[model samples]
Target chain A: PGLQMSQQQINPTRILVLLNMVTKDDLTDSDEYADILDDIREECRKYGNVESLQIPRPLPDLDVPGVGKVFVEFSSVDSAMTAAKAIGGRTFAGRVTISSYLDESKYFAGQFQ
Target chain B: EPQEGKRRKRSRFGEENIAERNLIGAQTVLPSNMTPLQQQCYILHLRIEDANMRLRTGRFGYSDDPSKRSPSPEPVYNGEGKRLNTREYRYRKKYEDDRHEAIQEMIKLNPNYHVPPDYRPPVQKLED
Candidate 1:
């Protein structure tokens, strides 16, 4: 009974991973990337206080996997959860956006810390 | 007396089955039975869970399947079909090299490096 109760009580996470938000070409120019980030951040801010935001810029050398994903950390888990639902299947940067909660440990990993 | 005992046994079994049914009904709702809007929300919940599972398991760099998008121009190569030794190439190479070193340094300051794993390398076709 206690174990079941604990499982049911799991809380939402405070980070969101926005996939395919921008492409490599979109990130090639620093100024353009910054502008894109600003646009994303502005849209994300509508859902909650964004604690941090990250978008990877893979160098031309390495075939860095998962390049166009965006991570947004919010002030509260509830807000992040709400934002993930609200953003699902919505169009962003001319592509359908697919977002999910970043696992707390993964959010703290070498990326998006 | 034997007949009475069998009836009592059947009644006890029936009560147990009803109790079990109630227990099941008391548990969380099932997604399959949800209304259309609720089902949609449930699916979104499952997708978020799936995404989180991939992230938490150190599967970031390897697992993402990106959607189709226009290919970006490839890095400029030389006329000899080799990566150019042009100033632009050197500059980009230097920047790329330093970027990782800077990331390491930043990690020392704030242990969580901001290298989110959502970058999908552009696919290249083999020329005939």
Candidate 2:
């Protein structure tokens, strides 16, 4: 599993997963959530065409998988690769964001956790 | 039995420590064939890394003791005078605002480019 993670870090995919970029409270407020979504989209568009973006929201009284993580699917692997390089380790919302390429099959299956 | 226990402890901590060290050292090397725009983006990424490290190392007025420094912009207090947020939260918010300013600078660099209609600029300031 560790080997696979390192391998994925070196490779590029169409889906990029960013961590530690947001907090649960930020998502709970509708206005704040909208602002965050807009900020992310605008920043990401600079790299390439974003096919879709997802940020799993926290559910009250329940632990949700992939909550607080931002997932971006680019239209091409090259775009995703560029975004991963540009965004990984960048500070967002005062947190050091960690970006990595996720397997397309796993992303499609919605296994964000 | 003592030796067995020692072996178990060593195996448990040793593997995890090595894995973590590798993960931290696993930054991808920049490819040589990148375009000028890509190079600029990479430089920004490196700058971000540098800033994060500086923060972690307590370079930007971060202290081990919470009371040593006054919270920037002042934190919100409830009616009873209890602070609504932690000191860490206040620092994080300030750091976030600083990063947004950096992004705004990056946007200004591309004067001819048109932002999307729905594009929202980063917040000028955040009030807790």
Give Cα-based local distance difference scores for all models.
Answer: 0.50, 0.59
- Tell me how each candidate scores on DockQ against the true complex: 0.03, 0.03
Query: Model 1: per-residue lDDT, tens digit, A1-113?
Result: 21011222224578787653576887888977877787778777889999998887878887754466778889998777677656644445423355555566776784442
What's the DockQ of model 1? 0.03
Summarize candidate 2's per-residue lDDT along A13-112 as a digit string, tens digits. 8888776567789899997788788878877898899988989999989988778778999999988878776776454654445566667887888887
Candidate 1 A-chain TM-score = 0.80
TM-scores of all candidate predictions against the true structure = 0.42, 0.50
Candidate 2 residue A83 C-alpha distance from true site, Å? 0.6
Alpha-carbon runs more than 4 Å astray in model 1: A1-11, A63-66, A111-113, B1-128
Segments of candidate 2 deviating more than 4 angstroms: A1-9, B1-58, B61-128
Docking class of 1: incorrect
